[model samples]
Structure formats: C-alpha cells, structure tokens
Target: MPTEISSPIQGSLVAIVTPMHADGALDLEALKKLIDWHVVSGTAAIVIVGTTGESPTVDVDEHALLIKTTVEHAAGRIKVIAGTGANSTKEAISLAAYAKSVGADASLSVVPYYNKPTQEGLYQHFRAIAEAVDLPVILYNVPGRTVADMATATTLRLAEVPGIVGIKDATGDVARGSDLIRRLRLLEKGSGKRFGIYSGNDDSALALMAMGSDGVISVTANVAPKLMADMCRLALAGDFAGARAVNDTLMPLHFDLFVEANPIPAKWVLARMGRCNAKTRLPMTPLSARFEPVLEAAMRHAALL
Candidate 1:
C-alpha cells in the first residue's frame, strides 16, 4: 500500500514580481533582496516567474536563469516554487527538469494556455510533467488568464498521479472549491494518496481556507508579506476571527492589487516602499496615474507605506 503524501507547503506563498531596472532589465540584486525579505517576513514559499513576474515576456533561457538564481539565493531559507508552466508540454517538462536540477523545492505549472486543451489533455499534460520531473508539481488553474479551466473532475483525476502534490485554485469559485475538497477527502481515503489546494486569489483565500484550502499563493503578499503570512497562519490555525481582523487591514490591497492588472499596482506599492523600480515589460504598461491614489490608499491601509 502506498503511504499518504501530505502537502509540504501551507501558508502565505508570494506570487512574487520580478524586479527590473528602469531600462526594463532584470535586477538580480533586487531579486536577492526580495528573497531575503520573504525569509524574514515568515513567507512559506515563493512562486517566481509566474504571471505577476511576467513569465510571458521572459525567454526560456531567462526563465531558467531566474529560477536558478532564486534557488541559489533562497538557500534553504524558504521554499522556491519555480513557475515552470508553458503552453508546450515539452517546454514545461524541460523547465521542471531544470528547476529540479537547480534545487528548487517545487514547480508551479499553469494549465497550458491559449491552446485550450481538453480536460483529458490537461490531465495528460500535468501527469506527463509529474512523471518527467522528480520535483513536486503544483497545478495552477487560472482560467481568467489561461482561457482553459481545469474542471474539478480533472483535478480529482490528476490527484492519483504520482509526484503531483497539490493545486493553486485561482478560479475564485467558492462553491466549486468546497465541492473539490469534499470529493478529495473521499478520494484520499480510498487511495491513501493525499493532495491539497491553495487559493490563488487573496480576497477569497480566507473563505476557501475556512472550508479546507491549505493556504494562499498570493499577489498581495508581494508588498505586505508579513500581513499575508499572519493572515494565512491565523486562518490555518482555526483563528478565523484573528485572521478576519488582520484581513480587514489587507482587504483593500486584496482588491486594489488587481485594480491595474497584477504587479502593476503591486509594483507601485513595492516601489513606494523602495523595494523595486516598478518597471514592467512592453505589452504590460505602467500603472496608470488615475489608479495611483487608489493603490496608495491601499498601501496606507495595509501599513505598507
């Protein structure tokens, strides 16, 4: 009989931004600084080169360099979940292999985007990566960006795949998230193979964790790592009231970070804190002037400023 595989991560995981210079070049120094900050801030892990990190713009070589640098700098202080997802299954496998070789603790592989593969294809795609790489794989489902949602059934099916440890549920559909948890419990009992779900959305993370989610893979954590870490810790510890209290302070950031497409407003706040230069790629424009006050107000509310 196969023993149960408990989740290795559970807490505030920052879907961190890639700090770039004003000229739009990668700032490895700033990246190291952020890693140190997360280690001190009690962040459980970091998902580097994810959506907020502008993975689309970074070429494959840059992707590997970013992951390798993060793993080296992190140096066991915090878990590094490298964003190794790609629309090409072959590319995804290669990236995951590179992550494992570089000592990354895990890989966050988003559902293949634009291709819009079927549910079965999704299973095969993720299962292939799990089989190909020895590193832990966390399935990322954000249909808002991917255009292909991984249904609960597909996730339930993928649960049986070895090396596939957990998922990041960004769908923000609480009812379905609850349903997946309920079903997973039954499945785990039958197979003795366990998996977990982490909320990919910060605003509804409390509600999801209240039901059964392990924690959050958060964009809000980019600026307010301490508060996000505290909230996840409280929620996971069954201190809903305390978590709620902390969340009341962060509620504005949860909504405001997305006010100008993630990492834009998030970078603005980080820059205000003098953490980074707040530069983004070409297609992803700078944070518009009109929304600055809204984000500023959020930063003040969260005490990030």
Candidate 2:
C-alpha cells in the first residue's frame, strides 16, 4: 500500500465564488471578506476563478486579475490555488505562468473541454502545460462538465511527470476512486513519490477520503467552510463515524447547492447569508425563485440560516 503523501493543500479547499456587483463587476471587497471568512472558518485553501467562479464568462484580463488579487489579499494567511485551466494548452500555459508570477501556491487545471481530446491528446495537453510552467499542477477531471474525461491510466502516466503533483477526481465513482488509490499505492511503493488525490465531488468527499484520498476541492465549503473543514479533518484521521455525523448535517447543503447550476445556487446562499451579492455573469443566470425556499430549508438544516 502507498504511504501517506503529506499534502500541503488538503481538507476543505473551497472552489470559491467570485463575488460580483449587481452590474456584473467584480466585487473585490466582497471577495476579500469571503477569503477572511474562510481563513477564520478553517478552510484549507481557496480555489479562485474556478468553474464555480465562472471562469468561462470572465475575460482573460479579469481572470488574471482575480488570481493576482486573491493571492495578494490572502497575503499568506491561506494558500491560493488559481483555476488557470483553458481549452487551449497554450492559453492554460499563459494563465498558469501568470499565476506563478503572482505568487499563487498552486494551480488547478481542468481537463480540456468541448474539443474532447483522446487519452493521448489529454496526456500531451497536460504535459505541455506542466512543462511550460514550474508550479505544481493539480489535474481536474470532471467529465460531466468538461466532456473529455482523463482515464486512470492517463492520470497515472501524468503522475510520473515532474511538476504534476495531484488530481481532483470529480467522477463520483467510488469504485473508480478505490481502484485509482490501489494503483497509486503500487506506483508509490516503487517510485517513493507522494501523490495526492482529492475528491471534486462534495457529496462523495467523505467516502473518497475514507478510501485514502487526500481531501476535497469542495463547492459546499463555500457556504459551510467550518463544517466541511471539520468533517475532512475527522475523515482524514480515520474517524468515519465522526465524519459521517458532520457529513449528515452537510448532506443537505451538498445536495441543494447543485439544485441549480453550481454558482447560481451557491451565490444565492452566500447572498442570503449576507456574504456577497447573488449576481453572476450573463450565460450563467441567477438561481430561480422556486429553489430559494428549498435552499433556505437546506441552510436551516445545516444551521447556517
């Protein structure tokens, strides 16, 4: 079996929402406040400009600014993982280089979307980015959103490459996760290299961690940072019963946050909690009125309301 990897970034790394004004401008003040809240709430790290942050809508300049601003405002109080992935490997390289220049601790690069590359294509795409940039790259494999999935073999191949440290498996298949863990253990035994595996699916995070994954890059953590962090700590320590108890309370938040497309519901919950405005870019609309009460009930269930 693989020995522990001692990952620097673990636990509830919130894929945080980018706070926006009613006019759809970036709300740096609200973003800073949210970061402060995460730090005090024991969140492990902050993932900015991610899908939850609407990276698809934000222009390149805005994307760079968000990453730079987050790293600066965070001021070493917490680790900032910039969502620098792009469909084009060249674009991703540029963004990741910028992330490195701005002092971000790491970069989360998602699988190439829309183009639907083959496993070999996927390998070259990520390898090019890793070679172009010096920072640690966390591969994000969320085929549901990205359309192109990185298979376990491709992931293991990439794991051997220097500068590629870990992955966020959002496949939500426990069997697949378990198999990957088994394979990684064998690889680690021979190479003695530490590889971190984090769950991208919030609802399945406890199960994944119990199977020896490192942590979660969570959407639910955006609203329930303290509970999510505590749950991860418990789960990592092999306290499944304790983790399950915390996960039970958060189960509602986990399910409801996806009631609408991601940040829509997440933004609404944050606004309801007086954290940020419920504004998102065009293409991505606000949470529907009907889901408001449902989300409210969920928040109440988690004692966040």
Candidate 3:
C-alpha cells in the first residue's frame, strides 16, 4: 500500500489565479500578496499554475518560476500543489521534476489533452510521470477541456503506483465519483492505507464531499477564498447544513463565474475585486459584456463590491 499523507487536505484548496501585470508578465509582487491573503483567510492549500493560472499560456520557464515563487511565498503556511500536467508525457515529466525540485507539496497532473488518448494511454502517460518523479501525484481528470477522461478503474490502477496519490475527479458525474471513492476505500480495506479524492468541479464539491471527498481544487476560491474554505470545512466535518449555507450564498457567483470559459470570468472577477489585473492569452479573452450584468448582479449579491 502506498503511504498516505497524515491528514486529508480538507477545506478549500484554491486553484489560484496567476497574478499578471498589464504587460502580460507574471506579477511576483501580486502573487506573493495573494498567497499571503489565502493563508490569512484560512485557505487549506494553495494550487498554483493550474487552469486558473492560465497554464496553457505560461511557458515552461515561467511555469517553473511560478511554482517556485509560490512555494517560497507561502513559506510553509499551507500546502503547495503545483500544476505540472502537460499534453506531452515528456513535458509532464520535465515539469513534475521541476515541481519536486522547487519543494511543491504535490503535483496536480491533468489527463492528457487534445490527442484523446485511450484508457491504456492515459494510464501509461500518468504512470510514466509518477515513475519519473518522486513527488506525490494527484490526477486531474477535467474532460471538459482535456477530451479524454480518466476512468475510475484507471485512476485506481494508478493509485497503486508508489508516488501516485489520488485524483481531482472533474467529470461532473457524481455516480462515477462515488464509485471511485468506493473502489479506493475497498483498496484500503485490504492494504491498510487510503488515497485522497478531491473534486475539481466547484458546483459538485458539496455532493462529492458528502460522499467522502477530501477537498476541492477550486477555481471559485480564487475570489471567495474564505467562503469556499468554510464550505469545505463544514462538509468535511459532516456538517452538510453549514456547507450548504455557504454554498447557497456562493451558488450565484459560482454559476456566473463559469458563464464563459474558466479563468476568463475568474480573471474578470479578480480585476473587479482589485486583486489583480484582468488579462489573458490570445486563445482566451475578457468576459463579454453580455455576461457582465449577470456577473455584476452575482457579485453584488455576494456583496463582493
């Protein structure tokens, strides 16, 4: 059995946004402040360079620098999970190694994207990464963009690998997520060690936590860290009512934040909050005016202004 972390990463683990200057460069000063804010606000963990960080746009050097800077800025105040996944297996290995070198607590590796690899391919791709690096690996199965979803069986298989820890199940399919939890628990029954399961979808996190998920790799937490952290804490403590109360307050913002592609609305909200400037790479753009009223109303409802 693979040795598990001493405790589950319960509560909000923010898939934090990368702070960018108006010139399209990473704002190290702003990034440090965001980390300090999350730590002070009771965020359980800090996830840097994930989808919300615009990983697709960040070059390898910048990506490594982001992870290193975040880890340094966090200063052991919270866990730092580096987003090191890439469509190319070799690239993933390279990134994972760098994350480990920089003292990342774990590596959140997404399922291979674009190429649409088969299940065997997914297992091999992740297996290669785990084998190549000693860092604890959390599989990221975000099929909405990745196209290829890592199935429960494959995730379980990878969990058997020495350094592969668990997954961020983002299929938005509750049944599949429940089944994966059952399977991992069953593995623990015989092996005496359990793996962690975190939800990738913000909306489904409450439900998944009700079913025993450890926490969520949340994009929503970037702007509303305290509420999201409180929600996850309540859920992990089996206080579903409390979790729901926070979720209900956050529901509108959550829905509106993703009215467009992730990081787009997320960036806009951060800018509006004065946390960071709103800028994105060529492929993604600012939130359209059509969605402005919806987001504004939600923000007002949340009293974020």
Candidate 4:
C-alpha cells in the first residue's frame, strides 16, 4: 500500500452558489457575504463559479468578474478556487490563465462535457491545461454531468502531470474511489508526488475520507457550512465518531439540496435563511414549490432554520 498524500488544501471546500437577484443579475454583495460566512464557518476554501455556482449560464465577462470579485474580496481570509473548466481545451486554458493572473489560489476544471471524449482525449485535454497554466489544476470528474467517466488509469496518468495537483471525484462510487486512493498512495510512494483526492459527493464524503480522501468539494457546505466543516475536520483527524455526529445533521440537507438540481434548492434555502435571493438563470428554474417544505424540514433538521 502507498503512504498518505499530505496536502495543505484539505478540509471542507464549499462548491458555493452564485447568488442572483430576482431578475437573474449577479448579486455580488450576497456573494461576498456568503464567502465571509464560509470563512467564519470554518470552510477551508471557496470554489466559486462551479457547477453549484451556475458556471454554465454565466457569460464570459460575468465569469471573470466572479473570479476577480472572489479573489479581491477573499483577501486571503480563505483559499479562493476558481471554477475554470470549459469543454473546449482552449477555453479551459484561457480561464485557468485568467484565474492565475487574478490571484485565485487554484482552478477546478471538470471533464469535457457533451463531447464524450475517449480516455486519451481526456488525458490530453487535462494535460494541455496543466502545461499551459501555472496554477494548480484540480480535476473534477462528475461523469453524471459530463457523460464522460474518467477511468482510474486515466486519472492516475493525469496525476503525474505537473501543475495538476488533485481531483474532485464526484462519481460517488465508494469502491472506485477507494481503489483509486490506494493506487494513488502507491504512486505517491514511488514518485514522491502527492495528489489531493477530494470527494465531490457530499453524502458520500465521509466514506471516501474514511478510505483516505483528502477532503470534499461540497454542495451541502453551501447550506450547512459549519456542520460540514466540522465533519471534515473531525473525520480527517481520525475522529469519525465526532464527524458522524456532525454529518448526521447534514445528511438530510445533502439529498435535499440536490432534490432540485443544485443551486435551485441551495439558493432557496439560503434565501430562506436570509443569506441570498433565490434567483437562477433562465434554463434553470427556482426550486419547485413542492420540494420547498421538504427541503425546509431538512434545513430545520440541520438547524439552519
């Protein structure tokens, strides 16, 4: 077996929501407040403009503004990780470069969506970004969204690429995650290179971490920041008992947030908590009224109510 992958960028990294106004304008003040909340709530990093942040809908200018605003306002209170993934290799490279220029600590790049590239295509896609950018690139493999599952072997190949620091495994398959972690440990032992393994699934985070995942890029943290942060901290410290206690409260929120396709329910919950307004872009609608009570119950269960 391989040894541990010691990375400082560990703990609950929140895949935060992009707050918007009633007319679908970016509510930047609300965004800054959310960042502050995460900072105080013990969240280790803020992944802005991510899937949860509606990165797909935001225009190019909006994207750059979001990254710039996050980096400027965060002011090193916490790590600001810009979501710079684009299906186009050139676009991904440009975004990553912009993130680095603006002082974003790192960039989270997802698998190329819609193209359904082969394993080699995936490797080249990511390798290109690593070569072109000086920033740390954390690969995000959410096959469910991208429709392109990155095999363990392909991930291992990319892990060796310079500037490619880690990955957010959103596949939600604990067995696969465990196997990858073990192999990565072995790789690290030989290469003396450490790659951060972060779980993108909030519900399954503890399980992956139990098998040695470094941390999580969590949607649940967008709502229950303190509890999520506490769980990650306790679990990473080998106190599963304490982590589970915190996780039990967050478990319900985890499923509820996704009940309406990410930022929908998440934005709604935050608005109810007076955190931000519940406004999503055109293609994405507000949380269905039917699920509001259900999510509210979950919020209450987690004491966010």
Rate residue 273 of model 2 by lDDT: 95
Q: Is candidate 1 or candidate 3 better by lDDT?
A: 1
Question: What local distance difference test score does each model get?
Answer: 0.90, 0.91, 0.87, 0.92
For model 4, the superposed segments whose C-alpha errors exceed 4 Å read 1-6
Better of 1 and 4 by lDDT: 4
What pairs collide in candidate 3?
A: none
Q: What 10-residue stretch in candidate 3 is worst by lDDT?
A: 1-10
TM-score of each: 0.97, 0.97, 0.96, 0.97
TM-score for model 1?
0.97
lDDT of 1 by residue, 62-163 (tens): 899999999999989899999999999999999999998999888999999999999999999998999888888989999999999999999999988888
Error of 4 at 248 (Å): 0.7
The TM-score measured for candidate 2 stands at: 0.97
Task: Locate the minimum summed-lDDT window of 10 residues in model 2.
Answer: 1-10
For model 2, how does the per-residue alpha-carbon lDDT over 165-225 read when each residue is reduced to its tens digit?
Answer: 8899999898998899789878978877788889999998998898888899999999999
How well is each residue in 1-305 modelled by candidate 4, as lDDT tens digits? 21222464889999999998888899999999999999999999999999999999999999999999999999999999999999999999999999989999889999999989999999999999888888888999999999999999999999888788899999989999999999998998988888899999998999999999889999999888888999999999999999999999988898888887878898889899999998999789878889989998999999987
Residue range with the least summed lDDT across 10 consecutive positions in model 4: 1-10
Superposed by TM-score, candidate 1 places the C-alpha of residue 224 at a distance from the truth, in angstroms, of 0.3
Root-mean-square deviation of every model: 1.7, 2.7, 1.5, 2.9
